[model samples]
Target: MPHDWKEIQAGDEEVFKKVFDSYYQPLCLYANKILNDIDLAQDLVSECFINFWEKRTSIEIRTSFKNYLLLSVRNISLMHLRKSGEKLGNSQFVIQELEYVEDYVNELEEEKQIVRVHQAINKLPEQRRKILQLAVYNNLSYKEIATFLGISVNTVKTQMGRAYRFLKEELKDDQLTLFLLFGSNFE
Candidate 1:
């Protein structure tokens, strides 16, 4: 659905919702990647959406709306960190993670794709899920994960291979998005 976001500034509520439904999860994930606290990330991203809606008539976005919303969330999350004086973790890691995801924003358009990936991952077997989590969530290499979990590298490799096949076969259209999101970990 191509949208005239410029027209959204004229108080088009329907398009506003379509935009909201489209970007909310990805923006939350982006903010969470930065803040590392899902609670704060959700709060900051929700506030961003609220403010976006309230000030919709005046918001001027020359870039894609995705960039604007992401920038807004990033700024607000950073501001929260600075104001609270909360040393959330390695700021370097947060910045690096943000940059990594931003590199793929152009390829990620449908929010449903993210939801589908999550659902598919949840449907995997218990050990397979653990392997995928250790790989993707912790960003651990197969050898590192095997050593840490006291398992053989072949077991780790096999589990990851099965997880990738499941996600690829189940999410046919979003294969690229899943690959782009989790490819580095599996490889």
Candidate 2:
């Protein structure tokens, strides 16, 4: 029988438990397919369930819970990949090996690097910082940034170039320090 998540949200713990039990393994397996790490996949699935439980009151079941869980796993996996700087490969063998370990420590280190990068950006002059933020964080093209900032495209490009140069100089030492501190073995 198909479980209606709406009913599960209506104060039915058993129904919710039944739904979770039914989909837990499958969701973890699906996440493993994307993340290539069994432990991370399991963690992602567990977090999904935690989120589901916390937000149960506002749950909407347009599709099956299975589909919902699968999508959540995929998104979480992608976020992990992005944060870890992992390359996407087409080799099944390599992917299988990725399932062996969950490098939470490395992920945390990468997060710290991201914070350092953010701080470095903040140290720039206000206009230069805005240009850099628009170009990098917002993924805006130089022309778009110029239009938004009411500046010439050439001026935007020049400012962005200077910003990158300054960032490179400022972060060079930190990058080496991070490499040493983090053991230089990241993806």
List model 2 lDDT by residue over 69-118, tens digit each. 65566667778888899975555643443333223323544676778877
lDDT of 1 by residue, 9-30 (tens): 7778888888878677777888
- TM-score on alpha carbons, each prediction: 0.52, 0.44
Count of backbone clashes, every candidate in sequence: 0, 1
Position 13, candidate 2: lDDT: 83
In terms of lDDT, which candidate is strongest? 1
Worst ten in a row by lDDT for model 2: 178-187
> Which residue pairs does candidate 2 place in steric collision?
36-99
| TM-score of candidate 2 to 2 decimals | 0.44
lDDT accuracy of residue 64 in candidate 1: 68
Decoy 1 TM-score against native: 0.52
Q: Give candidate 1's error at residue 58 in angstroms.
A: 2.0
Error of 1 at 94 (Å): 3.9
